[model samples]
Target: MSMREKIKVAAARYPNQRSAIMPALLIAQKEHGYLPGPVLEEVADILGVERIWVYELATFYTLFHTEPVGLFHLQLCDNVSCMLCGSEDLLKHIEAALGIEKGETTADGLFTLSTVECLGACEMAPVMQVGDDYHGKLDAARVDVLLDSLRAIAPRAASVENTSSQQPGE
Candidate 1:
């Protein structure tokens, strides 16, 4: 189904139109990779809500990305629990390994490293979130292993992208 249809269906679930802002944004982001100005406006238009309302929710949440992001987004939890459990050191190690600091994507656009306030997995402190999966109780070794695995997966993801982008005749 089209994004507009998906948004309408999602909006139907909520009594208030504003409540559908998040679901609508998620649908838009999944279709566009990121929520650019035009895409945000389209979502607002489709929902029959104010543009500011869509922009407000899209910008406020970390899950929604307004700018382009890499194939893998590495989010490290830097809250007190993670801090005490050595997230600071882990962050440094990841920066060195990936050759990119926080808020930056790798040269190949494979990874984007970021530090979030929390992941709400205090029991499994020192956690890193790559996409939707959480790798917790992390140390240098675990992080290294995780990075290596993601690297291996990158080529397959690239190939999939290339395949999907090809025209039937071309």
Candidate 2:
């Protein structure tokens, strides 16, 4: 089924099509990793709303990523608690280890580092979210282990994908 069809099905659960904007956007974002301009326009078309409305929501929510992200999207918290716990130094450590600045993905596309205002766990100061998992009370040692672990497994994961994609003769 097409993306629009799937979104329409989700929208059917709502009282009105407009009420399903969040689900529709989520469905659209899932179909495409990130919501580019064309994807936003298509979502607007699907919902019978202005393109700007879709764009506004896409830009407003931290959940909806506008650009393509790497296999691991790392969101480091920069809230007051995390800042006081040295999130800035943590950010630098990630950048140096991943060889990419904040808002940038690595050359191998394994990691994307970005900062967020909060991750809703102030007590877990100096916390970072890798995908859905959260690492709290971080130090440089933990960061090294985290990056090393991912880097070590990334090659094996890629090889599995590569092996699966290869043909019987090619």
Candidate 3:
């Protein structure tokens, strides 16, 4: 669907046009995989709000990718608790297994490795999140298994989705 069509759909759902900013941005991101400046402006235009308002919302949420991200976003926690539990080793294992450096996406755009301060799962230290799923108490072997499974499964899952239905804007 076109960006204009997405905006119209979002606008129809909200009581006020401005309230659709987040949902509109999400729709844009789902189509493009990230929030580019032009798309943000488009969303702002649709919502009849200032561009900065859309920009602010996008920048404030870590879940909203401002730039293109790989198919799998691997978020590893490196905070005090996770660090004490050997998150560094887990990070290295993931990097080596994926053949990509930290803060880098793989050549195939399959994976992106990123370190986060805290995931707020201290009890499950040395945790990593792939997409929306979390894997806790990771070791090298577990990380390998997790990546393999995700790589094998994600594409099939994505293909099975019915594109005709619009995803609800988170």
Candidate 4:
């Protein structure tokens, strides 16, 4: 379905069109991979709302990416709980393994790494979020497994090249 049609369907469930901004943005992001100015304006135009409303939500939420991201977005938790539980070291391990610093995407465009305030799973401290799934209790080994799995399912073989075999916490 077209983005306009999808937005209409999502807006139908909400009493106010403004309420549908999130789902609308989600639809737009899925279609465009990122929310650029034109896409944001298109969403606002379709919803009959001001551009700011849509823009605000898009910028405020971490889930919504205003800029392009890789095929996989790795959001590691950096909150107190996670930090106390060794997130710092884990972040370094990921950087070394991927050979890309935080806030950067690998040259192959398969992975983008970021640090988030929290994943809201303190019980699973040292958590990492990939797409919609939350991976908790992370250590070097677990992260390696996750990265291997992601690369295995990557759209291209380029995703597997140039990655380090160095284990986390080694």
Candidate 5:
């Protein structure tokens, strides 16, 4: 679909044009797999807002990808609670398993490992978010299992146009 068509769909969903920013961004990301400058501007224009507004929204939210990211944007919480529960070790395991450092995407563009603050699931410390799903109480073994699960589901997810896909250069 064209960019205009995509923005239109997003704009139609909200009562206020500006309120559609998030959903519009999601649609833009679905089409391109990341929110590049052009996409952000396109969204802003369609919503009758300034480009900086869109840029601000993208930067403020960890969920939005300003640069290219992998198919799975893995966010591990490293808050005090999670750290006490061995989140650091979990982070190490994920980095090793994915062969990418934190805030970096795998060469294959399959995974991007990142560290986040509290995920609000301290009870399930050492938690990580893969795409929109959260996996908690993770050990190396469980992390491996989660990766496997993600791999298994990735193809299906990519086939759905609205679902997240691996970003280019990831």
Candidate 6:
């Protein structure tokens, strides 16, 4: 079924079309991987709302990705608790393993690394999320195991080649 058709059905259950913006954005993201501008415009048109509304929602919420993301988006919480718990080290491990830095997507498009203010789990410091799963108490060993498992699931014969050795997102 088309995105519009799906969204139309979703909107029908809501009190009004506008109330379904969040769910519609999610639907669009599911279809497109990320909520690009054109997709947001289409969603707004379907909802009979202004394009700005869709754009605002997409950008405002961290959950709504506005650009292309890797197949696995690893969001590491870099807040005070997580940082104190060694999220920086965890970040380094992820960067070393994925060959990408925060705000960078792998050339293979297999992984994207990003930092979030909080994962809302202060107790689980140094937490990282891959897709919908939360990985807490991260260390070098665990990071390697996680990467290995992901690699085992979908082995990439070659790691993403870095175009420039310089820091990513420059």
TM-score list, all predictions: 0.92, 0.84, 0.80, 0.90, 0.84, 0.86
Best by TM-score: 1
Residue pairs with backbone atoms closer than 3 Å in model 5 (clashes): none
How far does residue 115 in candidate 1 sit from its true spot (Å)? Answer: 0.7
In candidate 4, what are the lDDT values of residues 88-115, reduced to their tens digit?
A: 9999999999999999999998999999
Off by over 4 Å in 1: 159-170
Candidate 3 local lDDT, 1-170, one digit each (tens)? 67779679868987988788888887788776789899898888878899999999998876688887787899999999999999998888888888888889999877888888788898888888877788898888888888889789878755643352345562
Compute the lDDT for candidate 1: 0.90
Candidate 4, after superposition: displacement of residue 88 in Å? 0.8
Count of clashing residue pairs in every prediction: 0, 0, 0, 0, 0, 0
lDDT for 148 in candidate 1 is 93
The lDDT values for all models are 0.90, 0.85, 0.83, 0.90, 0.84, 0.84
Question: Which regions of candidate 2 fall more than 4 Å away from where they truly are?
Answer: 153-170
Of candidate 2, the 10-residue stretch with the lowest lDDT total is 161-170
Q: Worst lDDT window (10 residues) for model 6? A: 157-166
Any runs in candidate 5 off by more than 4 Å, and if so which?
Answer: 1-3, 153-170
After aligning candidate 5 to the native by TM-score, how far in Å is the CA of 136 from where it should be? Answer: 0.8
lDDT of 3: 0.83
The TM-score, computed over Cα atoms with residue i paired to residue i, of candidate 3 is: 0.80
Cα deviation at 107, candidate 3, in Å, is 0.9
Q: How many backbone overlaps does candidate 2 show?
A: 0
lDDT of 1 by residue, 1-170 (tens): 67889899999999988899999998888777789999999999998999999999899878888998888989999999999999999999999999999999998999999999989999999988888899999999999999999999999977775665454575
Candidate 5: minimum summed lDDT over ten consecutive residues — where?
161-170
